[model samples]
Target: MELSLHIILEKPTAGVAFGLQKGSGNKYETVQIQQTDSGNLDFYLTVTTKGDRLKDALPRFGGPFIQGPYMGNFIYLDIGTLAGQVSPWNRRLKIPMAGITWEIIDQLSADVALMLKTNVAGTAKDGSPNCATVKPFNGWRVVSK
Candidate 1:
């Protein structure tokens, strides 16, 4: 079967980048969203899936936060659960995605995705962060495309 997971990213930081990987051991692939006359900055993540059961079919998600030459794991959504959600789902993420600066991005690791802090991207070094910040994102919605 073929299905598309729709992800709506509202106005995000110009340079900040985030994206999702289909499953483990997979790289990111971006979907092009046509610009509207309103001139809003938006992007989409359409996860193509196949399977008879949604639980068995949908794979766990692992995203990345990228700025300049630095990249770190951003978010993780493990599916196939009774809750059928990862965290902070269908709601605004509290943290400012803009904090993912090049100055501290390299210090982040995939472990940040585990913290599941709706707003906090984890603690940075010194005044350390356990998570890597995303860009200046207003909001995001993941549905079906």
Candidate 2:
């Protein structure tokens, strides 16, 4: 079965929190996103999973999707099977953004938009990124972290 998961990631410097609320389970704080108190780009990811059973894979999708002090320069999204594992947390299906010019982060927002349409439509198995896009992220080297 193919599953589509919509996930939200609050930008590191954004003065708002976009995550699960109390008793919210995994749903966002609100059904409709609140306008950011600070103007920073927050991530909204449409992740597709390649798997046989969504129930079996659903449990594995939460950890990496949660906000944290990742200390990485770029935002990451997983578009493959949640059950697939390379790292203990399963880091497959990331769109690379290494060496991407962070000089104008807004410019890169188009990449995220395009990805949400095309690449996010599908995914691969065995930890391979699915659905290639044109020069997706211009990575120096992509290692799913």
Candidate 3:
């Protein structure tokens, strides 16, 4: 039961498209970026997964955000269910500049694969427990046109 997820950061349109592909299945459960808001650039995602169309997964799955050092930024997707819980499926995606798009995509894909493997194996990937006090991503560069 291998699971793979891919996210394409659409720069020109300031949107994102991601899909989860299970083993041997060409079909993918996709999440399209419907809208973005100020303050952490919270993504309002429309998810179609497992025969369910979730109009908004943010409320349940937690919205993703971006933050990083100068000249680079990374998006973080929190899969944790609630505060003070350990999240095995948390994903951190780096937003690449125009020149390094392919590299970033490969990296993110690998990360997603590894996370899925660990989750399926029922092994805990050591990490700090999710806390509410942590500050949200301050930079909101991605804007909708």
Best lDDT among the predictions, by candidate number: 2
After superposing candidate 1 on the true structure, give the runs of residues whose Cα lies further than 4 Å from its correct spot.
19-40, 53-145
Off-target runs (Cα >4 Å) in candidate 3 are 1-64, 81-91, 97-145
The residue pairs that clash in candidate 2, if any, are none
Between candidates 1 and 2, name the one with more favorable lDDT.
2
Can you write out model 2's per-residue Cα lDDT over 1-145, one digit (the tens) per residue?
1112232222222222222121122542322222234433233433222222333321112233333222232223322122222223322233332232222222323343322212231223443333233234434321121
Give the Å shift of residue 77 in candidate 3. Answer: 2.0
Give per-residue CA lDDT, model 1, range 10-127, as digits (tens). 3332222233323333443332412222223333332221222334322222233221211222333221121133323221222232232222222222223221112223212332
Which stretch of 10 consecutive residues in model 3 shows the poorest summed lDDT?
Answer: 115-124
Give a tens-digit lDDT track for model 3, residues 115-137. 11101111112333222222322
Runs in model 2 deviating more than 4 A are 1-91, 106-121, 124-145
**C-alpha displacement of 5 in model 1, angstroms?**
3.3
lDDT of 3: 0.25
C-alpha lDDT score of every prediction, in listed order: 0.27, 0.28, 0.25
Better of 2 and 3 by lDDT: 2
* Root-mean-square deviation per candidate: 17.1, 18.0, 18.1
